[model samples]
Target: MVLHVVIASVAALAGRSVPSMALPKKRERAAPVVSAASSAMQMQPAPINPDWIIAGEPVARMADHSKSADRAAYTALWDCTAGTFRWFFAWDETVHILEGEVHVTAEDGSVHMLRTGDVAYFKAGTWATWRVDTYVRKVAFLRRPFPAPIAFAYRLKNKLLPAKTPTL
Candidate 1:
């Protein structure tokens, strides 16, 4: 598609290369290990939706967990190879970079750099472009996402009905 070509061209000009739109072969793997920290050596390439690719082949590896069937809370370790791509957040995510670097450009054009030990928050509904300068590794915490109005209401309720403190 024309969009893909445009994205690839723009990325090249920015000194980043993007892979073609062809779907890379998916390799089979065993179930992920649910743990507090990843061993790193066992991480595998994450499955990516083709529609999300922009340029040069960006690949991600992840080990993730969900709190429950309702999808309230989630956590994951994600690693990505050097590449450029688009990310649309549907859940509030807080990421702590463990290795490498990334430059993220928000929809408003503001740019942020994330490097080792840096933490970044992406609210639900945010649109951004992520250009990975080097292979990167991160640990991410994801909270249940809500629409604007619902989110506001939830916050207000929490303030009104605070949890009771236990007396010693």
Candidate 2:
């Protein structure tokens, strides 16, 4: 409860203004990622590789979004062997390294090498690859999650069903 209060307060401050990257009107439709080549985004790359390290940014986001406030928050850590992460989806997360080192490739191809006692902030929307050498553990938040099995079901439904709008 204390954590929630602090996070919300910070979010109200850090996320107070509308970022150009803020969700668009009628946010039901997710936006596609813009390329790094865009003049504006490319102008100011991080001076240091991991400037965001230890920054508790994106303090609140999709990784924990839920219809029920009762269950709006969730957390997890990863120590997988995938070696490379192809991309990320609709989620804003906080990753606190418990052990090991990770090479984080930003959606823009910017890179950050993080190790123990380091923290990284991932916004609600960005695609990136995470390469872990040893094991990794980090916290995360999610909204409208589709676990592997459930995601598979959704794929099948889309494949089998023709497009249609149903009456409620």
Candidate 3:
């Protein structure tokens, strides 16, 4: 559910339209997949929109791990230097802090201090203010959801025709 939201949000943020829920015409077997250690993955600069910065210059970096076939979901490693900024969640995002810490203030005036090993979820279409004192790193899981009508149809179809497990 959250994954779908994230994907939708990401698509919006990227100026891309959300993909339809329809399956591809040709079904193909998926290949085995693996990712290198986070420490070994090269991080690329992912600059924050200048207008979103409130205080100090924050430097951000990111490394993508994997993306779903339909491009509706993905995981990535992200980090940032000390700074205060407004983060607009374009997608549903669940983040697991890996290093350092950050203070996040939601639009509702609630504040959360997320440290190493902490996990937090940010809903799509929301905004939060983040303050990173020194540095912070996290793994972000994101997903885009189907439209309401399409989601309902999918749910109804699943209930009517449940998939059967294949015999090994």
Arranged by lDDT with the best first, the candidates are 3, 1, 2
Ranking by TM-score: 3, 1, 2
The candidate with the higher lDDT, 1 or 2, is 1
lDDT value for candidate 2? 0.51
Per-candidate TM vs. native?
0.66, 0.41, 0.74
lDDT scores in order: 0.76, 0.51, 0.88
- Which residue pairs in candidate 1 have backbone atoms (N, alpha carbon, C) closer than 3 angstroms, thus clashing? 17-56, 18-55, 18-56, 19-56, 19-57
Tens digit of per-residue lDDT, candidate 2, span 51-84: 3323322121112112333344444434433245
Where does the lowest 10-residue lDDT sum fall in candidate 1?
A: 11-20
Top-lDDT structure, candidate number: 3
Q: Which of the two, 1 or 3, has more TM-score?
A: 3
The TM-score, computed over Cα atoms with residue i paired to residue i, of candidate 1 is 0.66
| Candidate 2: clashing residue pairs, number | 5
Q: For model 2, where is the 10-residue window of minimal lDDT?
A: 56-65
Q: What is the C-alpha lDDT profile of model 3 across 34-93, one tens digit per residue?
A: 577999888999999999999999999999898887678889999999999999998889
The sequence of per-residue lDDT tens digits that candidate 1 reaches over residues 84-127 is: 88898888899999899899999999999999999999988888
